[model samples]
Target: MLQYIIKRLLVMVPTLLGVLTITFLVTQFIPGGPVDHMLAQLDGHGARSGADTGESATGGWSYSGRQGIDAAQIEQITALYGFDKPPLTRYWEMLKNYVRFELGDSYYHHQSVASLIQEKLGVTVSLGVWIFFLTYLVSVPLGVAKAVRAGSRFDTVTTLIVLVGYATPGFVLGILLIVLFGGGSFWDIFPLRGLTSDHWHELGWGGKILDYLWHITLPVVASVVSLFAMKTLLTKNMFLEEISRQYVLTARAKGLSERQVLWKHVFRNTLLPLITGFPATFIGAFFTGSLLIETLFSLDGLGLLSYEAINNRDYPVVLGTLYLFTLIGLLIKLLSDIAYLFVDPRIKFTAQES
Candidate 1:
């Protein structure tokens, strides 16, 4: 076990370097700097003014300057961030700084990246937790039902629902839900947003929760449907496969009841595959949430944070967040491999024998 752990840890070095390289290259492809994202739209407006009234008409303020990133500003930013240095030197510096957990500043927001992360982490964490718990609460029972009823009307209906949930894009789903639920035209159940009211702090604790729930109701429903559908389908397929195994047949032939055959013999083994997929699902959900569900719902999570960072060319925060999320995901996958031994007796038996 110790050797296995050491081996995994050793593998992380190259993985981290690879992550850094990929992030750096990908970010370079996006057009503009932080200044550009803010000012690019203003170029045409400024150009019209320049055409009507010459540059000298506005105290020599050249309105018809470059339409994209300010080259001078970009150069300064590049030099400041050591983009002007040798790539190898910068890479080493990045590796060293990250080792000390110094992720640097948010150039866009003019704040420490760490502090910015601390500020917005609560909402994303809270939403992720609630959605995960709700998903499991609903999915487990539904998965079991689908497994038991394999090809019946119940399974067919559920399979179709899951497929649709998986197919639907998060932004489309989010907008549709807000229109249906938060617009007050349909059920008239909740607010359009998914956070506490503006005066949320002034309310009593119970009142606060109530109001928060009201706002989050639509977002939560959207999140749960997308999340639960995938988990339920995976668990159902695993359970179905397990139910037909020779051991399950033997248990039934031994006069074991349907419940006993399922619970004691089938469910346990079925959980092995599910357990293997668990870490990837959890980690992928964390990163993709920034791009999808969180973005649409206006949740101030790491996902939204990354989006803002990219748009504003806040390289430090963007790179820092990317590395953190990637590191977490890679580690989770590694651990999942190890967890399989505990989840399956055959794996444990092989390890012990070795």
Candidate 2:
């Protein structure tokens, strides 16, 4: 197991490098980069200053008496943002910094990318934990019941509901939730935005907890809707498959009760897939499908931050976040495989077979 883990960790180096290379290349080639944005700002400033003083500001005066940026000044700006360096050189430097856990400063936010992520991490983590717990807590039991009562009225009704939920997008659900319960047109039960009330600091500990839950209720529900449908269905299918297996039949034939057969024999086998899936689902809680939900609820999280960073052409934040997320994803994949062994101890990972 230790050898397998070490091997996986070793493999991650190239995987991360490849991801960073592609991301860096894309950012470099994309239009409206940091240089262009800076030039546009400078041009706008020059135009306004020229209008006020009837003279070209600073440098890059055109013969036509128009405001412009000279090549020297442009070079200075480019160098300042490290854009003047060759792409490979810059990529090498970035990799070195990343190896040391240095994400550098955000060009737009004027703070280190790591610091910005740290500030936003708590909200995303809170949402992720709630979503993860709620998804499994509800899904597993519901799925088991549905599997046991397949073809019954309860199963039919639940299948319809699950299908409807699975068909609806999470963001769309968030919008519907806001429209219904966000105090504008209909019943106002939940807060429209934010992860906490304005007076959160003033509240007692228990009050703070309740207030946090209150604010997060709608967002969490919206986020979990689609996940619940998928997980519940997956669980139900896995359980049904296990129940039909010969082991379950034999267990029942050995005089075990239906409950014992279900829980002890079938349920234990059904968990292999679910347990292996936990890592991706839990880590994905931090990012997957969170952008619109965070935006709708005005939750400052990594998803919203990444969206803003991309739109604003904030490459440092974009690349930094990408690198971090990619590394985490790769690590989680390794952990998932390791977890598979725990779920089914019969599995083995020999170097030759692997």
Candidate 3:
């Protein structure tokens, strides 16, 4: 196992570089640099922009809108943020930078990426834990019921509901939820934004924690609701596969109770496959919440941070967040493989080596 782990860790290097290479190339190709995003945001004020305000028009100490930033300033800005050089040079720089564990300064937040991640860790981690618990508990029961009922009315109804849940994106669901639950006649009842009530600062830690939970419930629910169908379907498929196996049939032939056969022989194995996907599911949750739910609900997580970074053209934050997320995905995939040991020892890693 130690040797296996070492081999896997070794593979992570090239795997990570490949992931980052694609990310860097794709992100750089995205339209709208800092200047464009800044101007666009200012234009969204629904009033006279800098152009209309006669600043750029009269050459009175203003950028030329999208071209507003003069060359010297642009050069200085680029140098300051390490965007002044060719892409290859900057790429090499970034590789060395992160290898040294320096994530660099966020042009958007004006802080180190690590510092920003630390500050926002609370809200993101809180939301992740909540959704993980909620999704796990929910999907398992629903999956078991669907598997048991197979072709019954309950199964048909649930399958259709899962379709609907999958059809709606998390962000849109978040907006709809807010409209119904967060922003209806009782918007204030749920604390529409932030992780806690304003008075939480004055309360005891436990009180503040309870208040935080109350506030995060809606956002977390919206997130989990969007994911319900997905986890359920994955679990259902796993159970289906396990039930068809010969072992399950043998257990049933022994006159064992259906519940006992399903839970003991079936679930123990089926759930291992499910566990392999759990890490990916959690990573996907971070992305699903990134723009829609976090932005609409105003939670200060990586999602909201990334959104602001995008709108502001903060390349450091954008690229840094991208690296962080991609690394997370890869690490979790590794973790999932390790977890397979606990879930099923009969499963041999060497089997896949060929």
Candidate 4:
């Protein structure tokens, strides 16, 4: 197991490098980089100032216009943003900085990418935890019940409901939820936006908790409603498959109660596939799946931050977040394999298996 873990960790080095390299290359080739964005802003400002002064305004930095910005000024600005450096040299510098865990500063936020992430991490983590726990807590037992009662009215109704939910997009559900519950031409039960009320700091501890829960409820529901169909159906299908297996029949023939045969024999096997998937789902709780839900609720999370960074051409934040996400994904995959050993001891990890 230790050898397997070490090998996996080593493999992650190249994987991370490859992802980073591709991301860096894309950022380089993309139009409207930091340099061009800054220059465009300068040009707009120059155009306005020149027009006000009754001077002839060339589109970009002018040589002898009322706007003081010139070629030298442009060079200084470019150098300041490190656009003066060759792409390969910048890429090498990025690799070195990343090695020391320095994610660098955001282009516009005036803060380190690490600090920005730290600030936003809590919200995403909170949403993810709520979503992940609620999904399993509700889906697993519901699935088991459905499997046990297959072909019944209850199962048929639930199947239809889940299918409808699965067919609907999460953002669409978020909008519907906002309209119905979030003070939009309806009952107005939940707050329209934000993860907490404005007076959250003034509230008592219990009040604070309740307020937080209240604000999060709509967003969490919107995020997880679509997820339920997949998880619940998967659970139900796995359970149904195991129930039909010969071990379940043999357990029943051996005078075991139906409940005992299902829980003791079938439940363990059903859980293996689910457990195998736990790492991805569990890790995903930290890196949220839906930026739209966050946007709908005005929640400042990693998802929203990444979206904004991408749109604004904030390379540091974009690449920094990508690197961290990839690293976490690699580590979680390793952890998943380790979990399998504990979940089912019959599973073995050998060097030869690689």
Candidate 5:
């Protein structure tokens, strides 16, 4: 097992390099860049700076004059970031920095990408955890029941509801929730923005906990509802398949109770397929939490930070986030592979076979 883990860890190095290379190439293809973005920001303000150099007050310098200023600024930025060097050299430098966990500063935010991520990580992770727990907890049991009572009224009704929930986009659901329960038109039962109230620090620990949960209710619901449908269906199908197998019948024939057959035999194996999909599930959980729900509810999470960075052309933040996510994805996949051995006795990771 240790040898297998070591092998997988070794493989992740090239996988990460490939991901970084592709990301770099894609960023290069995007029109304009941080330089253009910076110039736009300084359009009206550069005039004041120019006055110190005996330039005009309006700083609406002639095209040639503006070109000269832009040239100088670009040179400074390029030298600072080593952009004038060969692409391969820069890529190598980036790899070195990544190895050292030194994500550079954001061009727009004026802070280290690492610091920005640290600030936002907790909010996104908290939301993801709630959604993930509720999704599996509620879905698995409902799925087992649905399969046990397949074709019954309960199963049929739940299937329909699950389908509806699965089909609805999270953003649409978030809007409906806000409008219905966030004071847009109906009862104002939940807070519409942020993960905490402004006076959160003033409250006692219990009060702070309650306030946090209160603020997260709608966002969590919106996220969980979108996730619940597919997982429930998958679990129900897995259980159904297990229950019908010959082994289940043999267990029953051996005088095992229905409950024992289902719990000890069927359910234990049913989890294998689910366990195999954990890597994708983990990646999905992190990405899905922030994009629509966080933005809609005004939660300051990683998704919002990525969105802002992309719009502002903050390459450092964008690339740093992608790099972190890729590393996590690789690790999750590795963990899932290791889990297979424990989840099923038949699976093996021997040096000879693996």
Candidate 6:
């Protein structure tokens, strides 16, 4: 197992490089740079404020209007941001910095990307923990029961509910929930946006905890509502398939109870296929932070951060988030492979190149 882990870790080098290269190529090919995004934002703000003054909002000297940006202004912006160099050169510099864990400062935030991530990491981690718990806790037993009671009323009802949950969009669900329970004419039970109230700092420990959970309740439900169906159905089908296998029949024929045959013989093997996809669950929890939900809830998580970064062309934040996410995905893949050895001891790993 250790040897397999070591080999997989080594393999991650090239895989990571491939990911980085692709990311760099895509970002480079994008039409506008950070400066362009910044100018557009400023233009929109000026129009909204009805400030016809030739000066920028920041009181910085004016630029040529929507007609065109001047060469000197473009040159200054490029030089400041190191965009004057070739893409390959910029990539090399970024790679060097990333290797040292030195994610550069955000263009607008005036803080290092690492610091921003640190601030937001706890919220995402908490969200992930809840999501992971709910996903497995509810899905596993429900799935097994569905499989065991196949063709029964319970199975039919659950299947219909799962299908409906799967079909509904998460954002749609979130909106409905907010309208119904977040305040609507019904009794309000949760905060509309944010992880805490404005006076959170003044609250006692219990109040803080309660407030935090109250704010997160809707987002957590929204995050996992759509996820439950697929996992439950997958687990159910895997178990159903295993129940039909010869090994399970042999165990049953040997006079073992249905429970033992299912749990000891069938369920264990059923989990192998499910376990193979375990990393996807972790990946979804860790990196894919349900951008729409986060944005709608005004939560400060990686999803919203990435969304804002991309819109503003905050390259440091975007690249930092990308690198971190890709690294996480690779690590989870390695962990998933390691988990296999424990799940199925019969599985062996050889050091052969293949």
- Candidate 3 residue runs with Cα over 4 Å from true position: 26-75, 83-87, 185-188, 253-255, 351-354
lDDT of 5 at 150: 96
The segments of candidate 4 whose C-alpha lies over 4 angstroms from its true place after superposition are 45-69, 283-288, 351-354
TM-score to true structure, per model? 0.81, 0.90, 0.83, 0.90, 0.90, 0.87
Q: By how many angstroms RMSD does model 6 differ from the true structure?
A: 4.2
Sliding window of 10 residues with minimal summed lDDT for model 5: 57-66
Residue 239: error of model 6 in Å? 1.5
* Residue 53 in model 1: lDDT: 52
Which lDDT value does model 5 have at 139?
Answer: 90
lDDT of 4 by residue, 1-354 (tens): 788788888999999999999999999887767766666566664346556646444222222332555889788877987889999999999999999999999987889999999999988888888988998999899999999999999999999999999899888998998889888778799996688999999999999999999998998888888878878988999999999999888999999998899888888888888777776687656675668878788888899899878765789999999999999888877887887877688887874554
lDDT of model 4 at residue 7?
86
lDDT of each: 0.72, 0.84, 0.76, 0.84, 0.83, 0.81
lDDT of 6 by residue, 128-197 (tens): 8888788888998899999999999999999999889889887888888888788876768888778889
Model 3, 1-354: lDDT tens digits are 777888888898898798778878876666666544444444442233456655432112222354544667656655676656798998998889877767888776678988998898777887788788788898988998898778889999999988888788777877677777775654545767888887888999899878987888778877787778877988888888889999988998999999999888888988786787688678866665555667678877877777767656677777777777777877888888888988789877764654
Q: For candidate 5, give the lDDT.
A: 0.83
Which portions of model 6 miss their true places by more than 4 Å?
A: 39-73, 201-205, 253-255, 351-354
Write model 2 residue lDDT over 280-300, tens digit each, in one string. 787767789888888889999
* Model 1, position 308: C-alpha lDDT score: 65
How many residue pairs clash per model? 1, 0, 2, 0, 0, 0
Better of 4 and 6 by lDDT: 4
- Which one wins by TM-score: 4 or 6? 4
Worst 10 residues of 6 by lDDT: 57-66
Q: What residue runs in model 1 are displaced by over 4 Å at the alpha carbon?
A: 26-31, 34-84, 348-354
